[model samples]
Structures are given as structure tokens and as C-alpha cells.
Target chain A: MIEVINLRKSFNGQEILHGVNLKVNDGQSLALIGGSGRGKSVLLKHIIGLLKPDSGKILIDNEDISKLRGRKLKRLKERFGMVFQGGALFDSLTVFENIAFPLREKTRMRASQIRKTVSEELAEVGLSGAENKYPAEISGGMKKRVALARCLVMSPEIILFDEPTTGLDPLIGKAIHTMIRSCQKSYKFTSIMVTHEIPDIFSMVDRVAMLYNGVIHAEGTPEEIQTSKDPVIHQFIHGELEGPISIN
Target chain B: MIQILTLLRIIGAFVIFVIRETGRMGIFLAEAIFWIPFPPYLFGRVVRQINFIGVKTTLVILLTGTFTGMVLALQIYFTLSKFGAESRLGPIVALSLIKELGPVICALMVTGRAGSALAAEIGIMRITEQIDALDTMALNPYKYLIIPNLIAGVISLPLLNFIFVFVGVWGGYSVGVGIMGLSSGTYFGNIRDFVTGADILEGLYKSLSFGMLITWISCYKGYFTGYGAEGVSKSTTQAVVLSSVTILIWNYFLTSILVA
Candidate 1:
């Protein structure tokens, strides 16, 4: 389980997150939805110990991870995997090498063993024959799949997806969503996804939380969120621009 | 009073900027040094970087060294000819190339070629969030990226400088002994008489320092590069310019100290 309480963060004296609180139970998938640039990504980074909060507590498995450092932080990170918005594949590495990176760096596995494991994970992510291809050589959707394969190779206990379907076509986004759901069902890792895909992804996740004004404005199951009467939730879900939600 | 205050503010800001950059560079260097001995040592990356920084740059260094030596020989011959001592061209050209021009020119070339490329590559990685990805994966960017290049730079520049000196001396030889009508024996003899082991060692030391400086400045610029394509471009430009300027400035200090 991951829990964030009173998380406050600022950059150059401009606060992006203000006393945000949230929780994800073990083996649960929570989709964090928000308008673009509303500190969704920043909040995710805080959970994973990538960014330290100014004043708050992030309890991962009931241990305070907010102030962890050095090897302790590294150990904490080893339990989580992240799929970045841009795929964030190593531009210099081939897909196989990229997927094989974490294993080679963090484990004692021999090259032959790593190759076999990487091949297996690649197949799991539906990228069986794309191993030798560089990230630049593949389509955006395929790159996202490759990123997923890389993340899955570690078999992390938790996975964070940052705008995984942002740049892909609708069909590709749907395919990625299906992949994530199926992979989660099989792997059973806790997932916290930051996305804007709306009703499309509602069927795929267990719960939905709307982040508004630097805090979670609504939290409930997908059905509960879908039937929400809150004006902000209604405006955001239906893609209505002229509502209580203003772009400032 | 307002103008004076504005001037003072500008000066204060510049000083703060300098101090901030220096502190950042210092911390980066310390981390790079600290992680040098830890496990998961990236031997393949170091070798690849060395090959890229050293082997791929051979032709440019060779051409630059040869032409520089040729020009130096020609000019030195002309200058000595006025005093009827044109035969002294060999020692003058050899000394200058080995002691100063070899390291400085080779470093400048590598700065423009390899240093700028490194900064741009890393800057692109930075903008694309690859560095953050490394952090998420429990990988140290300093160990994985910077250290290999740093090691490669330290190893590559001196070897390149040696090639530069050899090619440059030969360039001087061909011009002085072949085209300029100076006796080959006199030319070779002058070089043998004046050029010492210390001169060679001095070139090596200068090249070593130049390599570290170029790589350090370039990598630092890239690691802390700002956001977006514009940021990467700006970092690359700053990397090359800063490396060149620092190399020249440090070369003067190094020369003065080494000479003393």
C-alpha cells in the first residue's frame, strides 16, 4: 500500500502541490485523473521518492519513504517501476538492451540468463520481434509497449504510469490500456496511473480520483465517479470547457 | 544613487551565478569520483567512449596537426631567415608543437567535436527525462553516463596529443628539410639537440589536464541543461564555448606554472 498525507511541494516559491492526501490499498489500481499540469506527475514522482516533498509523509508499505536517502532510497526504488510519458527509452540502446538494463545493473544474473528473461518479458508485452529495434525505429505505440516491457522485466511490486497513452492514437491507446489491465491481472502489482483518457479507461481501472486545485477533489470506484453529480467532475468527464473548472 | 545600486545588483547577480555553477560542478565532480570504484563498473561503455572520443577523431586531429606544423615551420623559417639562421626552424617548430600547440589544438578540436556532441546527447536525454528514468531505476547517472566519458576523456586526449605531436613534427620535417632547402641533417640535429624528455612530458601533462577540463565542462553543461530543444541547443553552444575558453585560460596558467 502507498499513502501520501499532506504533501506540499513548490518550485521557486510557486507551490504546485498544496497539502494533498491520497491512499492506494495493496493490489489495487487507482487512476489519478486531472487537467493537464495540475501536479499529477509531481505527486506521482513524490510517491516514488523521485522528488522529496517540502512538508508531508509518503508511507510505502507503512514506512516513511519521504526522507529516505542513499542505498535506502535505492532499495525503495527497486520495488517500483515507472513508464514515463515519452517512453523515456534510452536513445542509445536497442530495445533488448533497454529492457535488459535493470537486470544487468541490479542483479547477479549472467548474460545468457538475462537474455532469456528479457525475451520472456518482451513476449509478455506483445513485442516479441522488436528486441533489436531502437526506440526511434519503432512507432510511438510500440515504444510505449517497449517501455512497458522494460518495466515488467523487473517484476516490480508497484508500477506508475505517467500519461502512457497521451501521444498515441485512440486505437493504440486502447490496446495499451488492454495490455496494462491484462498485465496487472496476471502480475497483481499495485498501479497508480496519471491519465486523461476519460470514459475510455474507466472500464479498465478499479478506482478513479480527480485531482483538482492541488488536491484530490473526488475519489471512488469508476461507476461512482461516472455517476458523480459534482460540477467539476461532470465538466471534466464530459469535456465541457465552460464550467466551474477554469484554466488559469 | 539608483544607477549605482543597479550596477551593484548586476554585479551581485553575476557573482551569485558563478558561485552557484561552481558549487554544482564541484558536487558533480565529487559524486563522479566517489562512484568510480563501485561495482557494476561499465567497462564496455568506457571502451566505447574511448573509441568514439579517440579513434573517430583521428582524421581531424591529423589534418589540423599537419597543417599547423607546416605553417609554423614556414613562418619560423622566414623569421630566422632574416637573421641568417633558418636552419634553427626544426627546434623552434618542434619545441612549440610539443610544448604548447599539440595539446591546446588537439583539446580545442575535441571540445568542438566530442564535447559538444556529448553535451547535446546528454542534454537531449535530460529534456526527454531519461536521467529521471535512470534515477527511478536505482541507477546513478554519474556512474552510468558521466564517469565513462570522464574516464574516456582522461585516456583519449593524451593519446591524441601524442599523435598530434608526431604528425606535426613530421609535417615540420617535410616542409623544412624537403621544400625549404634546409639540410635534413641540420634540421634533425637541431631537434635532437634542443627537445628534451621534459618537453614531451610537459605536452602529456597539458593534454591530460585539457582532456579533464573539456569533458568536465561539457558533461556538467549537459547534466544541468535546462528544458526543451532550445535548452539542449543552448547547453551545447555553451559547452563548446566554455570548454574552449576554459582550456585557453587554463593553458596559460598551466604553462606559466609548468615553465617555472
Candidate 2:
């Protein structure tokens, strides 16, 4: 289980997160939806220890993450994986090398075993013969899949996706969503995805949380959030511009 | 009075910023040094960086060293001949190349070639979140990224400086003996007599320090880069400029102390 209590973050004297609270039980998939620049990525960064919160307690499996430092923090972080918006694939590495990076760096696996594991991961992501290709040589969607394979190769207990499907086409984005749903079922990792896919994301995630004005405006099952009557939630979900949520 | 106060305030702010940044850079250097002795030594990466920062830089160093020596011999030959002291040309050229010009020029060239690229590459990684990705993977960016460059810089600069000085001496010999009609024996003999162990060691020390300064400033700039393409470009420019200026300024102090 992961719990965030009164998380707050500020940058350049402007508060982006204001004592926000959230939680995700073990083995559950939560989709964090919010307007652009609403600190969705910031919140994800805090959970992964990328950005330290100004004030709050982020407890991962009941261990306070903010308090952990050095080797302890690194040990805790080993249990987590993050898929960045741009895939964050190492540009210098080939697709196979990218997926095999964590294993090579962190594990004592033999070359044959590492190759076997990477091949299985590539196959899982449906990029079976594309191992030798570099990130620049592949399409954006393919890069995301490679990123996912790399993340999953570690079999992390928690996976964080930061706007994973932001720039892909609708078909590709849906394919990615389906891949995530299938992977979640297979890996059973606790998942939190920051996305703007709206209705498409509803079916993939078990729970949905809407962040507005630096706080989680509403949290519930996908169905409840879909049918929510709150003006902010309705305006955001339906993509309506004029509502309690300011466009700015 | 108000104008003077405003100027003082501006100077105060600049000083504070410099002090803060220096402190931060010192801490960064400390952290990079701390990770040097840990496991997963990354020897391959260090070699690759040495190739990039050292081997690839050899051609430019040779060209510059040769021309610099040639020019020094020609100019010094003319000046020394006027005073009936042309016999001192070899020693002057040898001493200048070994003690001062070799390390300083070689470092400046490296700053332009490798230091700028290091800053830009790491800055792009920063803006693209690759650094964050490394952290999330339980990999220390300092280990995988900064330390190899640090090691490579320390290893590469002195070797390049040696190459520069060797090539420069021959360059000077070609001009002093081959063109100036001086005895090759006199030129060689003067150089052997005048240049000492301390002079070569002084050059080695300067090169090593230059290496550390170039990589340290470049890596620090890139690691703390701001957002986007503009940020990367700015860091690259700053890395080159700062590394070059720092090398020159640092060479002065090292030379003063070594000479003393």
C-alpha cells in the first residue's frame, strides 16, 4: 500500500501542491487525471523520490519515503519503476540494451540469462525483432513499449507512468492502454498513471482521482468518477472549458 | 549616494551568487569523489570517455602544438640573433612549451572540444528526464555519468599534455635546426641542459588540475541545467567559456607557485 498525507510542494514561491492527501492499496491501479500543469507529474515525481515534497509524509508499504536517504532510499526505489513522458530511453543504447540495462547494472545474471530475459520482455511488449534498433530509429509508440519493457524487466512492485501516451495517435494510445492493462494483470504491480486520456483511461484503471487547484478534487471508482456531478469533475471529464475549474 | 548604494547592492548580490554556486560545486565534486571507490567500477565507460576526451582530441593538439612551436622558434630566433644570443633559442622554445604553453593550450582545446559536448549531452539528459530515470532505477547518476568523465579527464589531460610538449619540441627543432641553419646538436644540447625535472613536473601538475577543472565545471553546469533546448545551449556555452577562462587563470597560479 502507498499513502500520501498532506503532501505540499512549491517552486519559485508558488505552491503547486497544497497539503494534498491520497492513497492506493496494494495491487490496485489508480489513474491520476488533471488539467495541464496541475502538478500531476509533480505528484508522481514525489512518489518516486524524484522531487522531494516541501511538507508531507509519503509512506510506501508503511515506510516513510521522504525520511529515507542514501542507500536506504535507493533500496526502497529499487522496488519502483517509472515510465517517463518521453520514454526516457537511453539514447546511446539500442532497444535490447535499454531493456537489459537494469539487469546488467543491478543483477548478477549471466549474459545468456540476461539475453533470454530481455528477449522475453521484448516479446511481451510485442517488439520481438526490434532489439538492435536504437531509440531514435524507432517510432514514439515503439519507444514507449521499449520503456515499458525496461520498466517491467525489473519486476518492480510499483510502476509509475508519467503521461505515457501524451503524443501518440489515438490507435497507438489505445494500444498502449491495453498493453498496460494486460501487464497490470500479469505483473500485479501497484500502478499510478498520470494521464489525460479521459474516457479511454477509465476502463484500464480500477480507481480514478482528479486533481484540481492543488488538491484531489474527487476520488472514486472509474464508474463513480465518470458519473460524478461535481462541476469541476464534470467540466474536466467532459472537456468543457467554462466551469468551476478555470482554463488558466 | 543612492546610485552608489545601488551599485553596492548589485555587487553584493553577484558575490553571494558566486559564493553559493562555488559551495554547490564543491559539494558536487565531493559527492563525485565519494562514489569513486565503490563497486561496479565502470572501467569500460571510463575508457570510452578517455577515447572521446583524449584520443579524439589528439589531432587538434598536434596541429596547435606544432604551429605554436614553429612560431615561437621563428620569433625567438629573430629576437635572440639581434642580441647575438641566438644560442638561447632552443632553451627558450623548450622551456616555454614545456612549462607554460603545452598544458594551457591543450586544456583550452579540450574545453572547446570535449567539455562543451559533455555539458550539452548531460543537459539534454537532464531536460529529457534521463537523469531522473537513472535515479529511479537505483543507479547513481554520479557513478554512471559524472565519475567516468572525471576519471577520464584526470587520466587524459596529462597524457595529451605530454603529447603536445613532445610534438612542440620537434616542431621547434625543425625550425631551429632545419630552417634557421643552426646546429642540431646545439639546439638539442641547449634544451637538454636548460629544461629540468621540475619544469616537466610543473607541466604535469598543471595538466592534471586543468583536467579536473574542465570536467568539474562542465559536468556541474549540465547537471543543474534548467528546462528545454535553450537551457542546454546556455550550459554548453558556459561550460566552454568557463573552462577555458578557468584554465588560463588557474595556470597563472600554478605557474607562480611552481616557479617559486
Q: Which candidate is the best by TM-score?
A: 2
Question: Candidate 1 lDDT, tens digit per residue, A81-141?
Answer: 9999999999889999999999988888999999999999988878899889998999999
Clashes of each: 0, 0
Predicted complexes: DockQ each: 0.86, 0.91
Tens digits of lDDT, candidate 2, A1-248: 99999999999999999988999999999999998998999999999988889999999988989899888998999999999999999999999999999999999999999999999999998999999999999999999999999999999999999988999999999999999999999999999999999899998999999998899989999999999889899998999978887876
* TM-scores, one per candidate: 0.97, 0.99
Q: TM-score (chain B) for model 2?
A: 0.98
lDDT of 1 at B167: 90
CAPRI-style docking class of model 1 based on DockQ: high
- Give the runs in model 1 whose Cα sits over 4 Å from its true position: none
Please estimate how well model 2 matches the true structure, expressed as its whole-model Cα lDDT: 0.94
Residue A108 error, candidate 2, Å: 1.0
